[model samples]
Target: MSGALAVIGLGPGSPQTLTPEAAAALDRADALYGYGPYLDRVPAKSGQTRHASDNREEGSRAAAALRHAAQGAKVAMVSGGDPGVFAMAAAVCEQIDRGDAAWRSLDVSVVPGVTAMLAVAARVGAPLGHDFCAISLSDNLKPWGVVERRLDAAAGAGFVIALYNPISRARPWQLGKAFERLRQHLPASTPVVFGRAVGRPDEKIGIYSLDAVDPSAADMATLIIIGSPLTRVIERPGRSPLVYTPRFVEGGH
Candidate 1:
């Protein structure tokens, strides 16, 4: 409970998704910072300073939280999904490495939480039970050329792709280009899933063929899961459909 900073994962939104460790860390924090919308999911309590942001300037907020911790405050940075999966934990670490003396003075830790990909995969049964990979379609930090290369490689590797930051208002066409690159290595009939605002209210989960998905339908909050050619989506008679990519067959006929 000493003055330290921790990047806490609150999970997709459900209290059930929150790990006991993350809950305990949050309970011990004197202050918390997170995206504005995620703040509503956390109940307010006296003496707990909550800093909300528009989610764009996560770096600056994380830097400030580090400062608070250095000043003897138990600062916990909260993320909607897992912190290291395109979230604030890495940002804080980056700032610390870049000579933020205050941040270096404090003990920092990243607590894992349920990410969108995991939540989506769980909702769909197990689309990513086999070998998989993740990428961010946004070119904010990395160039499109680099992103394209990685996408193509992942596709050819037959890895289930969990695409983060797939689309946003400013970069609406990024996902389209990424899918195009991937298409070169994957079949059109491959199973694909779009999980919008996953684990939160207004969450929309859809499974379809890769060729049938429209990138325009995706938004910044959406997480896309494009499966390998071996993947399939099955509709059940009385339950929610399931997604799976067969790993192996016991017998070859």
Candidate 2:
């Protein structure tokens, strides 16, 4: 009997952000696999075996889930945010596409959840209300040249940019370089948001201008949003400033 594989997202470490479908998939899973910290967020259930691996071993972890499904175990591959966005779903799909005929026979599905970028955007105001683009600043998977070129294009296109995997212990300088790239196209006063651990207890969010922005505030867990030329920030008397990109461009359209 062929079993099933469900690629699920837990959504930014908050149980409240988990989608009903993702929760249901987890409830049905006989086995779960993901990065150690992300897997730790999953609620333990009777008869469910949890497999944890390093965050960098996404492909191997996905393959483990596939193996479990092949052995007639309902497997759930969990990611912190939406799996399709820089997570296990792409790894699982890559596995399926890589000449695995047995994987074709398995019942495979993706249960979507709130992505970190969107969660971070909401935590502030609607900075993505207009045209926007998301990119990962990590050069481990790709070259720094490619990341720079993409940043240049996004900046030239006037897109509000959401940056993921901004900084890590091994590669801390990339975020600063990305900011420099944006400085060429955007004004020094461009609004930038640093949302750290959006839904977690240690969550911290700050808004700054491109001139005053500090890339050092970012870590791997941070989601950085660089506003477009049209983005606006409305300050309140005794509350956080509201940051938003208008739905329409300047002038009557």
- Top of the candidates by TM-score: 2
TM-score for each model: 0.93, 0.98
Off by over 4 Å in 1: 249-253
Tell me the tens digit of each residue's lDDT in model 2 across 1-253: 7799999989998889998888889999999998999888987899999899998888888888898899998999988899999888999989888846898899999999899889999988899999999999888789999999999999999999999999999997888888988999999989999999988999999899998898898899999999999999999999989999999776857
By TM-score, how accurate is candidate 1?
Answer: 0.93
Model 1 lDDT vs. the true structure? Answer: 0.85
The residue pairs in collision within model 2 are: none
For residue 162, what is the lDDT in candidate 2?
93
Q: Count the backbone clashes (under 3 Å) in each candidate.
A: 0, 0
Residue 156 displacement in candidate 2 (angstroms)? 0.8
